[model samples]
Target: MEKFKTKIAIVSSLTAVMILAGTASAYAAVPAASKGQATEISAGAKADKKTASPEEQVYNLVTKLQPGEMIAYYIPDKKINLTDRILFSGKGYVLTDYDAYTAKAAQMNAPSLEIPETYPKDYKFKSGVLYLKEPDESSELYKKLDKQLRAEAAKGGKEFYTIPVEDGTGEASGAALTFVKGSVEISLYASHVKPPKPMEGTPVPFSNPDEKTETMVIGGIKCTYTTAPKLKSRLSWTDTSGSVNYSIFADNAKADVLRFAKAIIEPEAK
Candidate 1:
């Protein structure tokens, strides 16, 4: 168990830890403003210094938002840099590109929101972005983007972008519904830095690290699984382009780990 404690320390060292969906990379990259795009989604939100902050804008989009009310997207607002504000759908999966910096500290108070069990009328997901009918008086920015995106959806192109979220009504032993916004579950890390490699041959007495590179078939997707399991905590990285690292803290992670994995990956299987 001492090794487990060390494992927790090792994986915990990584900063900007978050959830998916997984990894900050998954939440990175806001939607680029289409030059011709003529509307702003945050139109209803006051743009004054305090409210104009990215955190506020992102918060405005979900304040008191109930299930089936607000549609979620993976769009990243490219205008800001200090902290990237991402809109996570119900599954509460947020991703960030490797180079992107998420406003984790700023988003600490994001309101609880959910992914509707069903898409509202005339709404759809395309290429990882969610496209929904423009609510009356909706932000022009979103309207323009949605207009173009909806057109693209008509063409039948899609990605593993959007996923459905259930009301956090059910509780599972290994997995539980998460409504705590801006909280990182598994940050699909794509940063240039990595954890310090343990010296070879000497047993990492602390976490009893078991490192391996293998492929895992979760939710029918065959992706490589790189595990950095330390005794108390585990960090696993997989894939190269958009490499993913999961931060798991549990006495028993098997059931919860796979459950969370399926929740994020299966939605894209459609």
Candidate 2:
């Protein structure tokens, strides 16, 4: 009888231990599930924050123009006096603001301006300027500005050249200009005076942060110009207090740069 009672007691103790172990496992599973759910929630929130709508992106990029700022278009009519306000031209098919000089040249009764056969394939006419594929010593404008460029290069200043064009009468006519740095030709343009004030912000005008980035097209060519971080408040007044960023996509980049410079220095159009 005593032996049987002891065996029964041992069996009961083992059963109790097994029940306690099972209870502990069930309790642990609850916390594990809860933690997994919390992790999933956090991951979902992060995903929501990262995804931006297209409208939001557009709003981030586009902004209202400051006073005296206007969008200029390239006009081919030689009679049109290109001053600080207007810039760029178009292919015969497209009315664009980018290729003001080239389009104008093409429109003139003047003999077809043949780009040197040696010119790179990427170079194209925009706003009467001949854009080179690679801006280097090989460019025609660079050769003209080489001496002044070398002097500026030594001092780390941007080199610029202004070539005054003369009519048969030898009067002060439109100009062809170029900007060069060492072996590289940066930009080129031809204009009566200079370019107008540039719009502020990145070249890809976006008002929304989530909007897709789009390139500005002039003629059939893509504009390579970029604006500075800050733009001039007035197209007519120079911003001596602030630094201005300007990009020239014209063939004679310097001419386009001059246009903007002149716009700042000259009086505003009424």
Measured against the true structure, the TM-scores of the candidates, in listed sequence, are 0.25, 0.16
- Please give the RMSD of candidate 1 to the true structure: 18.6
Which 10-residue window in model 2 sums to the lowest lDDT? 35-44
Off by over 4 Å in 2: 1-137, 152-208, 213-270
Error of 1 at 13 (Å): 2.6
lDDT tens digits, residue span 141-202, model 1: 44444455444434542321121122221211011122221232321122222344443355
Which predicted model would earn the best TM-score? Answer: 1
Clashes of each: 36, 44
Tell me how far the alpha carbon of residue 37 in candidate 2 is from the true structure, in angstroms, after superposition: 75
